[model samples]
Target: MARNKYDIDEALDSEFNIKHLKRLGTYISPFRKDMAITILLMLTSSALGMLVPIFFMKIIDDFIPNKNIAGIVGVCFLLLVINIINMINLRLKVNITAKLGQNIIHQIRSDIFTHLQELPFSYYDDRPHGKIQVRVVNYVNSLSDLLSNGIVNTITDLFSLFFIVGFMLSIDIRLTGICMIGLPVLMALIFFIKRKQRVAWQIQSNKSSNLNAYIAESINGIRVTQSFVRERENIQIFNNLSKSYSTSWMNAVRYNFMLWPAIDNIATLTTAAIYVLGVSWITNGVAGITTGVLIAFTSYIGRFWAPINTLASFYNSLLTAMSYLERIFETIDEEVTVKDNEGATEMPPIVGDVEFRDVTFSYEDGVPILNGVSFHVKPGETYAIVGPTGAGKSTIINLISRFYNLDSGELFIDGIDINSVTIKSLRKQMGVMLQDSFIFSGTIMDNIRYGNMEASNEEVVAAAKTVCAHDFIMGLENGYDTEVNERGSRLSAGQRQLISFARALLADPKILILDEATSSIDTETEILLQEGLAKLLAGRTSFIIAHRLSTIKNSDKIMYVDGGQIIELGNHDELMALEGKYYDLYMSQYDFLR
Candidate 1:
């Protein structure tokens, strides 16, 4: 299926001021009925609130003139009752808005997470981990605020404007007309400020994302920065990003801070004009222009300014909030290039025979990483692939696991093309240990069990024993319970490798790929690892990529790959007799020994 076309970066800038938000409105569609009821209650609250000024007008115009204490008390009590009801309605509206915002954000976060998991490894290769991390966290946070607070404030402001205007006209039409005279001017100002605010907010969000991306990269590569003594350079880069972020924020804040006061000053001037004109008319002579009516008009005027200010401030808030929404929507719009085929079947159990038939592959177009490579590893046999640093040895292993597909060719495991089977099932039959084995932060037992989460404690201990790691594990302070700090920083390189070895051992796959596994370990640990390897490769089909020929000397076959093609294939002794690529690589190491 073709992918959705949503520009995440642009959306972030515009704050999702697009058709998608209208579509996303459907998420709230389910609760529309409840929302309707809540809005009705809010309207009722607004209506009751308008009655307060009328009650005061009545007290001043009628009850005060008649000197009726009972009437005065009754009107005051009704006003109090209306105030209580309005408060209750407002609280309920807030609660409902809160729930709706949380639900939508939760749904969005979950969908993005699922999409990330479904995306191909190529997508990961192009984007950094820190960049993805920021998107998942900060983007989701922005979406929640936009949907929740932004929507609620907007609706309330509209309703308040409607209710206030209607009540003012009902009380006195001419005075109401006079109060609304400056509205068009205020609105034009608001529109102009909104544009400026939106731009500033966009700048702020972009700068912030850039700062976060840099921080993430710097911290992850902190070791390299220190080793190369690039700390000063890195700090200068951070300072530049931080300055841009702060400047953007301050620009947005400056505009936002000025907006409310500007609106207030305009409203104050309008209110003063109304009071002066109304009083002059009352003294001179005009219809329905009583002192009480003038006072009530002033009260309504004050009420109108509050909502207008709220709306103006909300416009600024929307820019920041919407920018966040755009970023989140962008991620949701991302295409998952790698997805399962509709009729893909689960891989059945196999005897681990593998074949690459006239295979050609590349990580990039026009540059082949492996070309016309054809080889086979029979069941229960060990095969070694010897190659120069970038001769496509690891690429071969990746192809076997289907981490990347062939550009033009077929890969078969037990005579079935791997693409015909579900990727999860295909991977289930294989175990791999890369040159740089990663150990996550967790207890030693937890890290090992990560290979197969359902593995029993007994199974875990047995796997550790098979990899010759059990004794060293027991000698640690807390044994298997010892915490492996972030990236297993607390453990030595050899110890980390042993733990990874134990992890792979626990998986118990029919096919195993070990790439330069013994190269990084100390001699003592190397001996322990070799002993473990003997037990591991005994009756399983294995593929080994190693720099040390001694590690794979006893393998059934050794294939020497050069220039993306296998130049020679034979057992170790046969390769030595040929005195070709294999002999040269072996002798180079022998010279170091001499």
Candidate 2:
């Protein structure tokens, strides 16, 4: 089982503030009835467990030496029945607790996924995908262990200790006191061991997170690694990380080894002292104490020490489990910065007009990407934006889609401020095709239908044909049913681009944004796609950002962007007449094309 990074530390935290357990209690509220039943079964199983030792004591004191055959048989039968009952109850308890653990894990996983969806892109921008995956998957699994086995073992251990100690005291207070003499020292040693190893455990946890991150990144970028021939270098780096993790783990283990033996020795000495005292008392004949009672007391002493030992060691497991809870809570506590306004209503159907008025925006505070930038595209008009790299063209497109909120701006679609409308409705009105397109590992039909999941098979094919994607798709071995493995790696770049076009067409968006959509296609395919593009661009307000200036020369307007500002805006002929930024860019590109 993969342990979560948080388990080690959070579990340790529980020792200090057990009240934090209330949080977990609240999380389990929905299944309280099931939990209650599981706890009941656990308590019953614990009772049955304690009964076995008492039964043995009875057999030893009453039936064994007397050779009472009927008494022996009855006791044996009772022991066998109790054993069977204990095993049955234990099985039921484990199964129910296991199910409860799974249900809680499922709920947590689902909540994490839903939260990810609600989170804005900014949250992902600064975080590693591997780290997120670790928290969601590995962490949840560890939490499952903590919730089921951790809880069950802890409750049973406490109950067993209470009953066992109470019974031993009832038999003889002096022996009981002597047997427990070593516990304070053992507990102190446990506290010392935990304190000393905690930092090492924390270091190990951190290294493990790094190791997981490294593996996740390396696997995902294996192509990059192989292409660059960095296999040996990566292996060395991983080895270094593994060594660090091993060293930290070993340090903690060393402390554990030293601490346990020391505790065992102390407990052993205490037991020896008890035996010596008992022998001296029996020899003196002060109080009438039988050899049988002393023998039974000796057995009880062994049982007591073992559970105490187990309970002492259990602190580590408890600490680790609490650590996992901390990490889980940390993730759950993360705030989604962007959310819908209260009582927000969905916008009406779009008529394709879009306007950005005095929009100023920045990803981080004060580092503006777009400043006082404004533009408008009339209904059914196609506007092309020609810009150098980092000229905020994509930023403008993102703004229109409200993928980000502007610092100070009023972006309107069909004359209503975009923020005033529901984000879902606003996004539903736009279609986007980027240079790098995504295709899932599924049938071509399924990939296309992703744009409109409810679209019929006939509709999917019709949409593909509309974008001139049908010929290439049908030419494949399985036609529309052919699987595209791993982001369409089985297909060519142009093929993926075509599928993307088909998807956008299926969406039938009112506003279209194409960011270097034809940049990766061959000249022949690009020329063919231009015909389809003309049809797709009709009846929609379209914004095209491209370095291929000739492709959008016939667009209603051309905007030349430089240094985060629109330097020129006019028709093709008008820009050529000006001989400004747009003219220079076109002339420079003309030399290469020619």
Candidate 3:
């Protein structure tokens, strides 16, 4: 069994880029009408909010000084109306943006899943399941705020800043000049902090993926851990992963918290400067400077910093979200390595003739698993492949199914190159059963019906009966309806294999490939399985990979393979007469049986 290793030191080169936003915009484009309405509402709300400080300024400079009761009452009423409208706009904007954000997330997640299905098997061979799951679930979820509040609030804050600045400069350019001193410094500080925060957040995100991968791998192999009495070691490993994740998160938090104090200190110092300079200017007999103007200047300054604080928060969030965005787009941009050629046609129903011509394959460069191998099988032929472990028996079946593209040469079915046909059409007519015998979490009926979704209940039971699985299934508490837990942990290995056999048989495939299909079965069950398999193999072309010599004795032809090359090809009696490699292997097993 291959162990899943979690490598935390892997380098992720996910620099923030504008093109990521452009690609993300495609998902958002579908809801452009709703987003437009949201933008309009946000603008209206910010415009109304900016007017409130002006109302206060007016009451101090005009209504209070004139002692006009009607003016005060009228201004208060107008302020109330503007505030009510602002509240309404804010509520509507939240509704629109929230729904639009969720919809965009749905579209993005759907696209990622669809793309994952199209990706070749080779892509998955190099990645961990948990890491991919994190991208689909956790990473995509991290974008919720960026799509909702980030876009809306950033726009609102920018407009509010523009309006607040215009109002402040109109009141007193001198006071505004004092307030403006900190603006450049604050912006520069934000820019500097953003760079550090981005790196911290990227590290944190990577740590999160590492943690998820570790947990998933540990849980999947909990049985092995317990079997070896290594639970303590596993727990220690988990603790290490958790500690690293927490440390990275705290580092990011430390950098993020730095932003708030920096912005606040600048705002505070600017306010203090305004008060000191304004008092000095007024007391020194400056012309056209009054108490009301001074009061309004303070009010404008308060309004000014509020948006700055909001923008600061938004910037921090964008930095964090950019890390997730980079990861998500990275997965989305992965190429589908195995795809039909241009103008490829749908494969017609197979007559079960498979041929490999000068096939060469390798998982990596310069390490060939299959080197220039060629063979042909006619329709309804039972071809058994007997090989030592790692002799490329399974690779032959994987190539026939088009799971991975060949590095060179051609594989054909009924004279049509497998690569030249649509993958779905080519794979639909083939049934494969591997040694692992994986069973999903579902009732026995559903598991069997998976091979043919349109198969009726009676047809499923019939397939089960044909595989000698009906007897054991009926003995269960709920018969076909009995629930199988995850990976069929509730069932024995032989039972899972039988269920998988039933699934493959239900498909009624034209070509069947059994890679150690009966490895888990006992002698008694094997006898019954062979009886049913004889009937099943009557008219279909089949390939069987087996280590047990007894299983392939009755096969029409047995090809003995070793070191990626065929050493002998004949029926059992003919190979025994030759006394070659196959004869020695058979006699060893024969003596072991005796």
Candidate 4:
């Protein structure tokens, strides 16, 4: 499945989408005041830039021709002042736009993260973790260039283009006409190149996501890879993914680099044509053809193409950013499959009576994992569920916690429909510990206190003692303060399980779930841990899923499940007396138990 996810091609939508642009604009709406000031600054800077060429024209046609030293000096001073103002406005514009861009990206990243948290577990079940991480971190960051400089600079370039065109037309309409012969050609080239660039960029982004996903998966399974001596195979896979990413990047960059030279060639050719035509007209003594006018027109030609070149570059960047925007919005616009319904209220403290009324469920496909399963447990009862590997034991626990919604029936806790109450309220009263206990990178104390943030240091210690974790914890160099490296890599499996027990105990939940909780511990350790668990489960309703049947022998009710159906339900002695499926399972492990 991971390979398939990595192999999927990222197809781009339209090259330049106005809808995506408008949606992006909504992020900037909150900082309108900053954006407005930026726009004003951009206009002022561009206007000043346009005026500098006009001043050059004035020096050539008016001040220099009139032999007016005082006029030339005054014009020079005025040009200097204009340039100073332009520089100031440019600086302020950059500062404001950068801040605005960062803020908008920050908000977008935050929204994506918050929304991801609200999505159903099924959403994650169908996606790769690294792919989602890329969208939140890399794709959103790609918008910074476009937001910070692309929009404002593109507008400024347009203004400069117009101002230069108007000034040239006012000077000599004939020359202006000749200089613009390359305009249509340049526009066509840009349009053609933009489409290809968009496709290339989309491919590049997809490859990057694939590479990241592979890296994340590889790093997570490095131990397994090494243990199986498959390092060479993993390296080969990584190299292939990296090569693909590099190829896509090169393709995108080829189009980007292609545009600049294309624009430059056109600009250069147009400038040469203007100079030749202006000189010929002057030699032929055509009307309105002066040396000053010719020189100024030459200067205006450079200014004209400068903005055109800038706009063309901005167009390329805009296309690339549009691709990133499409990916980002795709994630942000995903419908949250699970959420609180309207008028849903918080549930009061639970009494731990859980009931499943003919609950049926499946994953993405409609093949039922739990079909017409019905059960009920009274408050403060310990219900043990024993089953084969895929016989729906854990599915029952998931349903009781409302991690998933029922397909055909209802689940109730303390007589209240679970779906009728807020998810937060429903989950707050339940504590769960699974077989693959996850330990975060933090001090042992912090990891334990994670179950109850408000737990004091004393409470944390007490909980650790209750779970038989305090003795080993105290033996460590830092005791409770010992940092468990990422996923508790420094600790043994049994040590991690003990800490998980402490975390669940800290919560003081009304209901508890232990899924193979003692499977990793040795018999000696399991015996001590069971002592702690006995006290922990004394008053709370508990569900235990265990392959080691002895761990659940004391459960008030033991259920043997097979093929998503409860085959036997009785106490330990009663099930043994029946000599049915339960008896056979026990007999198979009888030698080990003895």
Q: What is the C-alpha lDDT of each candidate?
A: 0.81, 0.77, 0.86, 0.86
1-594: candidate 3 lDDT, tens digit per residue? 022456554466656787877887788788888877887887787777777766777787788888988988988898889888988888888888888889888888998889998998888887778888898999999899888878777777888789889988888888888898988888788777777899999989888988888888888888998999999988898899889899999999898888778878988899998888788888997875677778778888888888888888888888898888888877888988899889999999999999989998998889988888888899999999987888888888889999998999999899999878899998889888888888999899999989899999999999988888999999999999999998999999989988998899889999998988888889998998888999999999999998987888989889887776677888999999999988999999999999
lDDT (tens digit, per residue) of candidate 1 on 1-594: 111111122233333365656756867687677667677877788778888888889999999999999999999889889988988988898898788888877777887898888777776776656557667888677667667766666676689888899889988888888777878887787777777777777777767777777788888789889999999998988898888889988998998888778778878888988989999989998888998899988999988888888787677766666666666667778876555567999899978899999899887789998899998888998999998988999889888888887899899999999888898998887888887879999899999998899999999999988777898899999999998888788888778888888887788989998887777677776777677789888879999999987889989999999888989999999999999989999999999978
Q: If ranked by TM-score, best first, what sequence of candidates would result?
A: 3, 4, 2, 1
Give the TM-scores of the predictions, in the order they appear. Answer: 0.91, 0.91, 0.95, 0.95
> Residue by residue across 1-594, what tens digits does model 2's lDDT show?
123221222222333446546877766788878777776776676666666656666677777777778987887887788778778878888898888878878888887778888778677765666667777887678677767666666666677778778778767888888887787877677767675665555556556666777778788778899999999998998898778779877876676576568767986897788788888887888474556557767777776766666665566655555555566666776787666667767989999888889899887787877888888889999989988888888888888887777789798888988887778987887888865688989999999998888899999998888767899889999999998897898888778888887887788899888888777778877777788788878888899988988788889999987776788999899999999989999999999999
Backbone clash numbers for all candidates listed: 2, 12, 0, 0
lDDT tens digits, residues 562-584, model 4?
A: 88778899989999999999899
Candidate 2, residue 25: Cα displacement in angstroms equals: 2.3
Candidate 2 off by > 4 Å:
1-20, 193-199, 252-263, 286-288, 305-314
User: Ten-residue segment with the worst summed lDDT in candidate 4?
Assistant: 1-10
In angstroms, give how far residue 468 of model 1 lies from its true place.
1.9
Model 4, 434: alpha-carbon shift in Å? 2.8
Backbone clashes in model 1, listed as residue pairs:
8-330, 15-322
